[model samples]
Target chain A: MTEMAHALRVQNLSKSFNDNSVLRGISLDVATHEVVCLIGASGSGKSTLLRCINLLEPVNAGRIWLGDEEITRAGIDEDRVRQRIGIVFQAFNLFPHMTVLRNITLGPREALGLSRSEADERARGLLERFGLSEKSDDYPDRLSGGQQQRVAIVRALAMDPELILLDEVTSALDPELIAEVLNLIRELAGRGMTMVIATHEMSFARDIADRVCFLDEGVIAEAGPPDQIFTAPSHPRTQRFLQRIIAAGRM
Target chain B: MGDTKRSAGRGSRLLGNRAVLVSTTSTILFFIAVAVVVALAPGSDIVGERFLNWVHLKQSLLGTATAPSVAEAFLLNVRMFMIAEAIILVLALVIALVRGVPGPVFFPFRAVAVVYTDIFRGVPLILVLYMIGFGVPGLGLGYVSTRSDITYGIIALVLVYSAYVAEVYRAGIDSVHQSQTAAARSLGLSRWQSMRFVVLPQAVRRVIPPLLNDFIGLQKDTALVSVLGSIEAARAAQIYGAEQFNYSAYVVAALLFVLVTIPLARFTDHLIARDRRRREAGGAAPGALGTAAGAPHDVPGAIG
Candidate 1:
């Protein structure tokens, strides 16, 4: 593959919670406009790694580069770094008190300092794209799980970030609702939005992922194209995990 | 059909039970006995004289005006009580916001707040007023000028009510869901900004009804200012009734209090109903999601 320009690079990323080491010397790189999937069992440091990428959870020791921003250095302006990265949580953490329109507009208006009219116009366009135009006035509690998660994606997109990190976006939804949210992500991947998703929806990953990295015990056990990773994972742990998840029809 | 008829028949039999009749009759008798005892108790002649003397003392309070002494007394009492209660509420909210929640740096502040609340809540308002109005001056704090009686009464009220209001605010703050804070922070809002924009707005909404109830309590408790010889409404009524040997003045004062409290109580009830409706509407939308997923986790837990 052409050395597709690097959008993010992590070297020696490590984190420990008291006696428990959550991430151990994890190193990875993602190309610009690429969709990378990190798949792993529970407690394998997938979520922690995602959080560390945005400096939401400070890593114990590591270097992270978002383009050339050098995010892991001491006294890095976190707000500036965060402005470039958008994250969506499993909980669909939409501000409850705000209307769907306001929820999508808040970060852009506040962080990007967009004028109200501009923010509203951008937010309206995004909502329309997500098929949530009619639900703008309603609160998150008013929306279905699939609709709420889709709104969450739009909320992150409104920031116009260089990269988006989605942590277990479908894990919290019903089986039927999961497909709708995954479909939205798949659409985004097809449009080449430079995304990193930690998900158990293996079928979507197989279909949309440009590359897949299997994380085991705080490190990437294997990383390759979707075809090789799914059908011919070289690592024994990756093979076993794929077998268990496929058998269980979830991970 | 047989089971339904049998249950209905059993319900009728229970309704006619003698024990229920005896308990209802005894409750009525108890209230009647208390009323009779209160009515037969010594006439207010002795208390009437004392009340008259008190009224005379209050008449000179604002210094001999054409304002009916009774009206003047009532107004003065009300003014003093309102001033005191307002100060108490504002101070209590500030204290609660600063020191009520659990935090390392606020531990000492919280401890101090607890002690302050305990001391005032533990002692009677009358005792607090007496100390500030009379006791301190006796200790060469110098007879607090009669002009300052209203001020002293307000201080006393603040000291006492702040404790109660603080607890009310503490409960309101604690009621906010931790997830709201987490969500706000994850969105990159600083701690104070999260509190200002998110938590406090919701917390304040939840506490409004209780805060109004506390206000009504404070209004009624304005009677405690009487111990300090302030011309508050209740004291004014008592004094006027004593001098004239007519209970109408006291009744008028009670009516005035009801006038102030009733509207507020009604407004509070309306607010509570409106809030409930809003919550119900917010929750109703999630039921649609329920059908999509057998059980999607609802916004997990009570919002502040």
Candidate 2:
């Protein structure tokens, strides 16, 4: 990877909640439009690292540079930084009270100060592209889990964000619905949307990610290309982790 | 209930075998009618002459042009209720906002909010009315012009009811999943924007039934404002009844209050039932993830 051509850089980042340290000395760099997948067990701090990069959770120590901008520095506006970087959660937190169209348009109209017609037009286009145009008027409660998650991705995309951090977007879906959300991610990747996804879908990660970072006990135990990590991970911890995943038939 | 009904059909009589349910119910109704007829008859020891005399008559049924009666005073009650309710809705929301404002920078304001909620909520509505309505005027503060007692009474009601309402709103806000705010924040909404545009809309729906309960309470308590010297329905009834030596005017006011409150109360119940039915309908979801690792909504417990 060309480090100077990086779109995102996190150098020696650390975060903790009440001395229960989550992310410890994490460091990584992502090139423009590169998709990096963080694969780890529940307590390995994959989610925390993503949250820290988003400034959702303040870091205990470290630096994160978004392109040429140092977003972690004090006096920097967090919301402006967030507008450029969309983050989607596993719960598909599309505003339940809002219809599908409203959910997608809110961020653009409110945060970005886009015109109502402009936001709605773009949101509708995204809705149609995602096969959710028919359900645009329906509330979040009306959508299936897969549809909600897809709409969530569309909501993030509506911002026209440079990077998207997806935190286990399909973990809550039923086994059958998981494929629907994963397919959407696959589409995003194909379109060259840069993303750092913290996910449990190992095969999906292995197939889609340009580089896979395996986090173990709050640090990256292994980082490599997909084939290397999936087939012949050098780190014993990465090997053991993939072994457990294979035993469970999750990969 | 089904099992009990089947047993009852097998002659397991709850009332009596000879007294069939329909005849027993009608006989009970007949006895109640007999009692009403006796009391309503020309002269009865159980009911006073004033009640009997005022139960019917054009003057009691509709107030006279020259006198304070239910018809004339009903508007006062409505005026107070509408104004207090409108003010309370806004004031309570402000109070809740002050109470829940984030960060240590607003600690003093939060403390003031806590004290305000604690004092007004505990001081009793009557005392608040007495203090603001009567006591404020009694202070002889020359700069403070004594407005109409009705205004002072409304202010007091807003003060006290707003405290109760603030607490209710806070509970509703607390019940909202933190993830809702998180989702909004991740989308680049400001803290206030997330709260105002996301959390509050959802919170308002949750607190509507309780807020309406307070509103109905406020409606009835409009009578309490009468003590502050407003000749609303209750006070008008008191005045008319005192002169007429009949309490039917008070009954008229009570009936009117019941008429207003029953519909509002039933509407609140309807909203609550609808909300619950929607929730129980299944996990298609309403967007709140309950802050679970995965949105643990329709599952009802921690999702595996």
Candidate 3:
């Protein structure tokens, strides 16, 4: 991928919460249709960084450019930028009061100003793609964790975002349910949806990510092709982190 | 397995029967005691005169041949009370929503709401009406002083009930999961938008049954407006009965109250039953999971 074709770019991004900096001067880039996996220990700022990229958490400093639009600058149309990017949370935040179909259609209808029939048609098609056609009328609370997470992805995809942010999408699921969510994600990656995923699933990152980033102490420790990042990481901190995670089978 | 099932079924049936018997006997006993006290009380003539007057007035209000002059009295009273209660519900709902949004930004608003609720809830409803209808006018609030009694009654109900409704809203907002807020934000909804579209709807759903109960309370409380002598349903009946030395007027007023309150009570019961069904069908699994997750912490401190 060429530099000009990057889907998202972060430059000197920093964020603090109540005087404590959670992300400090982090910079990264994702090429169009590329899958980048962010792997790190707790409190390492991987999640914070993902949130900043999606503008779910505001950055204290620096710039985030999504294609030609400058999202990090104050007074930028944040909603417009957000419309181009979709985010899925670890908690599978499907609205409990809404049926699965409504969950997927709400953002599209409200943000994009799509008519109800059009939104419904799009939602139905997306749910069918996610193999959740039959569950469209059911509430999120009725779904298995894996199924809910998949519906969450479909909800995001229905927005037709240019880029998607996945924040530990499988972490809240049962061990048996994790694979199904991850497999759905892997399929999205295969279909060329530009994605930045914060995950602990080592095998997924190794298999699906075009580039893997190891974040530590609120900064990227190292980033490279999956093979190099996994088997031949140059940073000692990255190696130690990988060893600990692998030992815990949290990879 | 069949024997265990049979035993469990038998035990459940016995417990159910015992509960039914206990409730029925308690109710009957309570009525019997009330009747005995009323029958045996002193000042029988004065009490009987007052009682009979109330009854006669009520019967006249109910269109009985005993007193036709009081029929319009009952209708006017019922209309005024119903209007006042309706105003109270609407005002309360609005106040509750404004005070119920989560965050420090809403803290001062919530504090004010809490103070309002405490003051009104602590004060007698009659006192509140007197203050609003009489005291405010004395303070040169011309609009209030010049307004009709029905208008004053509605205003008083709105002011007092808004506070209670705010607390109900606060409770409902607090009941929604924190994760839902986070999820809405992640979806790019502004804080206000998220609360309006996502959290508030869910919170309102959870608060519906309680809201209905509050409405019922407000309905009964509307009778207090009669203290202001506005000729609301109860006061209208009271006036006719006192004049004619008949007791039916009070009975008529009581019946009117029953007519309004009984349907609301039954509706509340239906709401509660529906809520329970929803909980049993969808909530039980989540509840079990939650308890299971919490159970480990409880085991070490168990007495056994």
Candidate 4:
């Protein structure tokens, strides 16, 4: 892809938790309006990479660029950078004290400095679009796991972010409830939103992602379209990992 | 199956009735036995005449020509408690927030908060009362130091209780999950904004029971201010006891203290019970994160 089309760029990213290294000198480039899927087993640095990109966890050594802005440099306003990107976690961390409308409006009103009426209008529109307008006054604990996850997605979308990160968004839901969240992600993908999703749903990744990167032991061992990676993988580790997934009937 | 279920329910109700009967009999028998033993004691009449004299109780509550009314003097204790409680709430929250500030930039502020809590919490409340009550006035700072001894007593109370209340607030803040802060920060709220909007509300709600517990102690400690010779209820009772050579006035003062605090204690219990029920119903979550709003049961006057 051309330099101007790059939505996010990371160079030699490395992270560690004290003595245990997670991401080891990883490089990634995501293009505009592109949906990239990060697939890997647990503890393979998938979540860490997403947290690093959002500046939630300070990187030990790395440089991240968001649309030509060097966000990792000293004196960069991390809070302003975070405002431009949205992240949805597995645990739907909606402020339980707040109603759905308040949770969605907080970021917009606080960070963007929108008037209360303006924030409320924008939040209501997103809630209606996500089929949650009726539940806007309810607390998150009152919602089902699936409905809460959808509200979380709507919460992120209310920010009107340039890029969104999804970290195992469906992993916490019941199997029957996973479809609603997956459908919402599919809708976002259809609308051409730039996203980097770390997920374990093999089939959903195959359907929604334009490019799939299989992370192994802290690095992307294989990268390609879903058809090539799933049906005919080049790397031995990729083949082995897919075989296990197939044996487990997850693919 | 329906017959079995009905019989089982009847059996439980019968057992409950039998339990109530047995408990009532034992409680009545225990109280009767204690009364007989006390009536047979050698000094029972003397004790009763000295502490439970009905005429003296009446006179002590209403005050006499020579002594101030214990009831009226109690208003000073109530006033001191209310002012000190309000100041403690705000000052303690500030101290807690200062200690919670992160990064090296706030190191000095955090250090001051630490030293403050440590000093006040470590010192005895009565000693603090003595020091500020006597020492500040002893400084002779003109008009500033020459204020009423009641003012010094209130300051002492605020200094000591805020330390305790600050720890309670810190515990509540720590009980909030780190994920909550992460979510707020990821939404681009500054650290202070996240704390102000997201953290403090939840923290304050979670610690209300403990905060009330501290306040109950504060209510009783209002009597400590009498050490400054402010003539509050306890001091009034002391003067009456010395004049009449009877301790019945002390009982009157104790009853007055209990009259104010019992309602507050019940209110705190109700808050705790409601919070527990909400948690059990919410199942794993702390439930609506606790609204710091109106209490279901109105606790008479003089308390929020």
Estimate, for each residue in B1-304, the C-alpha lDDT of model 3 and write its tens digit: 7876779878898899999999999999999999888878887667777665644544566554433444565565567657766676667666676566567887987777667778877887787788877876677766656876667776777777777776777788889997787776656666776787788888887787787787777776777877776666667666666657666667767776788789988988886786786575543222322222223332221210
Which pairs clash in the backbone of model 2?
Answer: none
Candidates, ranked, DockQ: 4, 2, 1, 3
What would the per-residue lDDT of candidate 1 be over residues B112-194, giving only the tens digit for each residue?
88789889899988889888888655666444554366777778888888888888887887788865765555555556666
Say which docking band candidate 1 falls in. Answer: incorrect
Off by over 4 Å in 1: A1-5, B1-93, B100-147, B241-251, B273-282, B285-304
Q: Which scores greater on lDDT, model 1 or model 4?
A: 4
Backbone clashes under 3 angstroms, per model: 3, 0, 22, 0
Model 1 lDDT tens row, A35-128: 9999989899889998899888888998999997799999887766777888888888887767789888877777678999999999999989
TM-score per candidate, chains pooled: 0.76, 0.88, 0.84, 0.94
DockQ of each: 0.21, 0.34, 0.20, 0.49
After superposition on all CA atoms, what RMSD does each candidate show versus the true structure? 7.2, 6.1, 6.3, 5.0
* Candidate 4, residue A175: how far the Cα is off, in Å: 0.8
Residue A247 of model 1 has an lDDT of 88
The most accurate candidate by TM-score is: 4
State how far residue B102 of model 3 sits from its true place (Å): 10
Number of the top DockQ candidate: 4
Q: Comparing to the true complex, what docking class would candidate 3 get? A: incorrect
Model 2: how far residue A178 lies from native, Å: 1.5
- Docking quality of model 4: it rates as acceptable
TM-score of only chain B in every candidate structure? 0.68, 0.78, 0.71, 0.89
lDDT of 3 by residue, A1-251 (tens): 43459899999999989888888889998999999999988899988998888887778898999997888887887777777899999988889777788888887877788999999999999888878898787667667778889999998898899999999998888888888888899899989999999998898899999999998888898999999999988999999988997888866
